[model samples]
Target: MDAFAIQRQLTGIEPLNGSNYTTWRTSVDIMLGFLDYEFVLYEEKPAAITEESSEAVKLLYAKWTKANTIAIRLIRASIGETIRGDIPVFNTAKALQYYYLTQFMSTSYDGSGSVREHIYKICKLVNGLRE
Candidate 1:
């Protein structure tokens, strides 16, 4: 599908309020991955281009910059205005992902649930952190 079509579909994802973070995050991750913008979550940003920069270095820098910019914009757009203000400004997609993980991932599991359920929740949280 074209970028515009994918983006239009992404608009269907509900904005993140504190309560819907998990579902919102999964939707955004899948959309970004489809757009090839998920790399900014894993790859370190390349050094800024200089006059003496090699073609390969320049290309890498451009690719990273484009992905980072798009990912940041998409993420900000997905956030609910009420909670968006609470998040500190982030320049990179990875930093934004870390902020969301730290803010949303609940580590404390109450003893009210079955052991299997608790384990499943723990595993899901771990997978989110890994991403």
Candidate 2:
């Protein structure tokens, strides 16, 4: 699909509230991967461009910067306004992702709960990690 179509799909993901972290994370991860912006989550930001920087280095820096910016914007856009203030500001997409994972990864299924439901939740968490 074209960039615009992919972007529209990304924006269609449900905005994350306090309860829907797993679903929101999985959707964002898939959309970002399709857009080739997932690298911003794994790759460290390149050094700032300087006047003396080589052409290749400058190009790399520019590419990384664009991806980083887009990824951050997409992530923030997926967040609900009510809880957005609770999340600290993060300049890098990777940092924002790390914060959310740590903040929401914890899950507990009491033995009294439906086995199928607990299993489903576990599967979702596993899928989120795989992304």
Candidate 3:
């Protein structure tokens, strides 16, 4: 399949910049699903193009890597820095998503930041629990 065909299927989801990891994760996941790009999240094989691989598989792998690269670019700088070492050296896109979900999804509110930030976190915690 042509790459643009798949790219056109993707939603115009905003890049994640750490301001709202929860929403960003959700949006990106939905967008990826819409584009049928979930393999980048689950598969460990097809890491790179191999001489033995067929042309179709090679194209699919290229799409997968492109999706991952786009996602990596969307990540906010600070968030990226925080997770830089934690992200798997190989097969990063899916691993990065998992890292953010595990680290930020269950964060506790310590009332340490600005009032607005604290309120947002408290609301986030409440919303997360409700979900």
Candidate 4:
């Protein structure tokens, strides 16, 4: 594929709801590949650079997705008052991944965490809000 087309396809360059599954999946593939490339870059930099970047990215994703869920829940909390409508994507797993990626991937582009630490830090950002 052409570089321009590939670039457009990878970072999830369009609105989610309007995209076809083929486009979305291809975009996701592109995104993951991009993330992997970033990780490689980090590995090539100063030794600690890779680890720190990885940690930041992973934790950021955890926090971001949880917060996204919280955000939607908050919106739902206002249902019948501030917002009203069946959220078309709420019940799907892919929706959750999209939430995680869209919110956190920019930060997590490097992938340095030990997994456990990322969870604790990011999940903590969700706070105690019920939504």
Best by TM-score: 1
At residue 44, give the lDDT of candidate 4: 21
Better of 3 and 4 by TM-score: 3
lDDT of 1 at 22: 78
Per-prediction CA RMSD (Å): 6.2, 6.2, 7.0, 17.5
User: lDDT of candidate 4 vs native?
Assistant: 0.39
The deviation in Å at residue 34 for candidate 4 is: 33
lDDT by residue (1-131, candidate 1, tens digit) is 69688868678889976556678888888888888888898888888899999999999899899899988888888888876676677888788557647745645667898988677556544543554
- Look at candidate 3 and tell me the lDDT of residue 77: 27
Arranged by TM-score with the best first, the candidates are: 1, 2, 3, 4
Q: For residues 1-131, could you state the per-residue lDDT of candidate 2 as single tens digits?
A: 79789868976799976567778888988888887888888989888889999999998998888888888888888888875666687888777546546645676766877998677556544543444
Backbone clash total, candidate 4: 6
Q: Tens-digit lDDT track for model 4 on 22-121?
A: 4533444454344333222112222323444787766655544554444344323323321133233463223434444444444342468677756543
The TM-score measured for candidate 2 stands at 0.68
Query: What does the lDDT read for residue 66 in candidate 2?
Result: 88
Q: What is the Å distance of residue 108 in model 3 from its true position?
A: 15
lDDT of 3 by residue, 53-98 (tens): 8999899888877877665543332243543443444355656445
Q: Which model is ahead, 2 or 4, in terms of TM-score?
A: 2
- Residue 29 of model 1: what lDDT? 88
On lDDT, the leading prediction is 1
